[model samples]
Target: MTFATFIKNTTQFLFKAGFIFWLILAILELLMPGFVIYYINMQLWLIVVCCLAVARAFLCKEISPPKADAPMAQK
Candidate 1:
């Protein structure tokens, strides 16, 4: 695979993972009154993870595109 494809796939994976983690935390918080602290901590971590994932998705780029005369190579 190419670098761009790798970045896209990894970013999407991270986003999905983060979303699932946050969802679980939310459900736990709703189900248990004593889980406030856990909820807060999880929320903070989730925010950080989401930010990092977005940054990685936006910032990562392939160094160069394949030239018209060049054969494409898989990463």
Candidate 2:
């Protein structure tokens, strides 16, 4: 596997896993109310931000227009 492929897969995995993990944490917090659980639940926002950043990075990596200095249009 190439480096690009690995990065792409990893970022996608992170997004999916983070979403699922947040859901699980939310469920646990709801089922068993406590100070610790509430604090842990607060981290869901952090997880969401991280997942969005990962997704943005992956998309940015995949989207790059041709460089202006490389060449000019033939037509």
Candidate 3:
């Protein structure tokens, strides 16, 4: 794959990972009660947001037409 494609895929992976991370963070926040949890929760949220934003940027690229992959078609 080309560099751009690699980056796009990485971003997509990161975005999906962020969803899982967010869920884990929510669960941890619910299960535990402490000042440290609050700090960790805030940091995780920021990282997740950044991941989503970077993935969104990759998805909005105007330089190339959308790729037609079998994985997408399966959905």
Candidate 4:
């Protein structure tokens, strides 16, 4: 796969993962106090990394179009 596609996919995956992590953490905090507190900092860093990756993906150039030499369907 192309670099742009790889970056885009990676960012998407990370975003989903981060979202799920926070959701779980929220549930845990509601059930128990001080538990999962250590993960707060780590989760924040994950958010930051995901944000940076998304930014990079947006800045990446669009994929090139197919070449004319490729085969075409016959009528």
Candidate 5:
């Protein structure tokens, strides 16, 4: 496989794992009160910022405009 494909798949897997992590956190928070309010200690804001940055990078990569062809010489 090409390096670009490998990188894309790895990023996709990471995003899936991140989704699962948040799902588990939400479940725990729902099951036990104050789970998010007091128990968690990591820098959630930093993580959120990083996630948004990565997402934006991928978005821009996919949404970039098509390159225009060179114009033909005038007759």
Candidate 6:
């Protein structure tokens, strides 16, 4: 595969994996009780995963249009 395709696939994979991890953590939090410290830790982890996912998506090895070029897509 080309470098661009590889980067895209890797980024997508990481994002999906992070989302799934966060979902499982959220479910565990809901099912369990009286674990305030664990809940807070999970929440922090979820935030980190979400941030990493977004960063991976945005910083993938692909070129994006600049602001001037991007405006045309909205029309």
What TM-score goes with each of the models? Answer: 0.53, 0.54, 0.54, 0.56, 0.49, 0.51
What's model 4's lDDT at 29?
75
Top candidate (lDDT): 1
Candidate 2 per-residue lDDT, tens place, 22-56, comes to 77766777787773464654576666758676675
lDDT of 5 at 52: 56
Residue 27 in model 1: shift from native, Å?
0.9
Report clash pairs, candidate 3: none
Backbone Cα, N, C clashes tallied per candidate: 0, 0, 0, 0, 0, 0
**Compared with the true structure, what per-residue lDDT tens digits does model 1 show for residues 14-63?**
77787877788778877986686643677577787879676776766557
1-75 per-residue lDDT for model 6 (tens digits): 999778778777877887787677677666776544454676677677787777786767467566564445554
- Taking every candidate in turn, the Cα RMSD to the unseen true structure, in Å, is 9.8, 6.8, 8.5, 7.2, 6.4, 6.2
Least well predicted 10-residue stretch by lDDT in candidate 3: 33-42
Where model 5 places Cα greater than 4 Å from the true spot, the runs are 34-75
By TM-score, how accurate is candidate 5? 0.49
Q: Which parts of model 6 are misplaced by more than 4 Å? A: 34-40, 59-75
* Candidate number achieving the greatest TM-score relative to the actual structure: 4
Candidate 5 C-alpha lDDT tens digits along 1-75: 988777777667666676677667777878987787486643584486468558746743776577898898899
- Pick the winner on TM-score between candidates 3 and 5: 3
Candidate lDDT values, in order: 0.74, 0.69, 0.71, 0.71, 0.68, 0.71
Q: Which tens-of-lDDT digit does each residue in 1-75 have in candidate 3?
A: 998778777777777777777777777777775624746656767677786777668675778776776565554
lDDT of 4 at 65: 92
Worst 10 residues of 1 by lDDT: 34-43
- Which is the better candidate, 1 or 4, if ranked by lDDT? 1
> What tens digits encode model 4's per-residue C-alpha lDDT throughout 2-65?
9978877777777677667777877787799778776566567566867856675675546889
Model 2 residue pairs with clashes: none
